[model samples]
Target: MLTYLFMGIALLAIGFAVHVLKWNILIAYYNTKPKEKKNNKNTESYRKILGYYGYITGGIFFLLAFLEFQGISVPPTPVTAVFIVWTMIVMYYAQKDDEDEK
Candidate 1:
């Protein structure tokens, strides 16, 4: 059950990445609002950054799900910690990039 949930999240993240990669407007680092879609700056860089992170996050979730499905003891703390750190790091860089262009 838990594994299924994780897999679902994994698929969603990967799908988001793919969509952003192809459309460059589906999801972005900062300009997510419909009104701001047409004014997204540094779109190429932001798209790549977001897509790569999404792929990485999806891969992490998929791995965790696989390990759990295989009867491996997967601790929630470690995964949660990693996700927190990852999100903070990504956000920092994304913000920096956004600010640098402004």
Candidate 2:
């Protein structure tokens, strides 16, 4: 369980880094497939949402892992609920901002 938690954290961290750095490796790989070009506004919005989600979820998982390691058990139900609510709030604001920009 601990190993899985760590693995998830690592994956989230990598995803966050990839978004922040705009690493071309993944972009190049994705571009290999023929797809219609997306407008800059849509691309930015997608990146913003992805970056926020990765950062928030990664932090939550790290906190849970740390607490578990320290023998402090948190009820999974409440934590999961809070995470969902928080993610919804974030998405709401992100979408709101996009709407305002338009």
Candidate 3:
């Protein structure tokens, strides 16, 4: 059970990282697009949101890596399951948020 919790947390960290990478790539592509002025409000908003994701995901990855290195684990399966589900839901929302831009 504890192993599962560790594994799930590691997986959650991975999922978050994949998302951050995707968003950064998209942001870079958007920035590099041919445009005369780059001060548009929409571009600024997208950069802000991507910054938020990067900060949050980076922190999560750091914390999880520390926990994994220290071998920390929870005893309850239900809580771990909930965390994994919640992480997935968050990832879905993050991706959905980007869909409107497409």
Model 2 CA deviation exceeding 4 Å by range: 1-18, 21-37
Q: Write the per-residue lDDT of candidate 3 for residues 5-102, one digit (tens) a residue.
A: 45546554544543444443455535665564344445555555555554554455456556756877534465557656865776465446556656
Order the candidate numbers by lDDT, best to worst: 1, 2, 3
Top candidate by TM-score: 1
Deviation from truth (RMSD, Å), model 2: 5.1
**Which ranges of candidate 1 are over 4 A from the true structure?**
1-29, 32-40
lDDT of 1 at 54: 72
Clashes of 2: 0
| lDDT (Cα, 0-100) at 64 in candidate 1 | 77
Candidate 1 lDDT tens digits, 1-102: 376466548655655754464565454444454565546656666666666777677777877777778898788888778888987898788678877876
Select the stronger candidate by TM-score from 1 and 2: 1
Best by the lDDT measure: 1
Please, what are the lDDT tens digits per residue for candidate 2 over residues 1-102? Answer: 374377458648765765787642443323442355333354555465656677767776877888888888877788768777976786677557655765
**lDDT of every model, 2 decimals:** 0.67, 0.62, 0.52
Model 2 TM-score (2 dp): 0.64
TM-scores, one per candidate: 0.69, 0.64, 0.41
Candidate 1 Cα deviation (angstroms), residue 46: 1.7
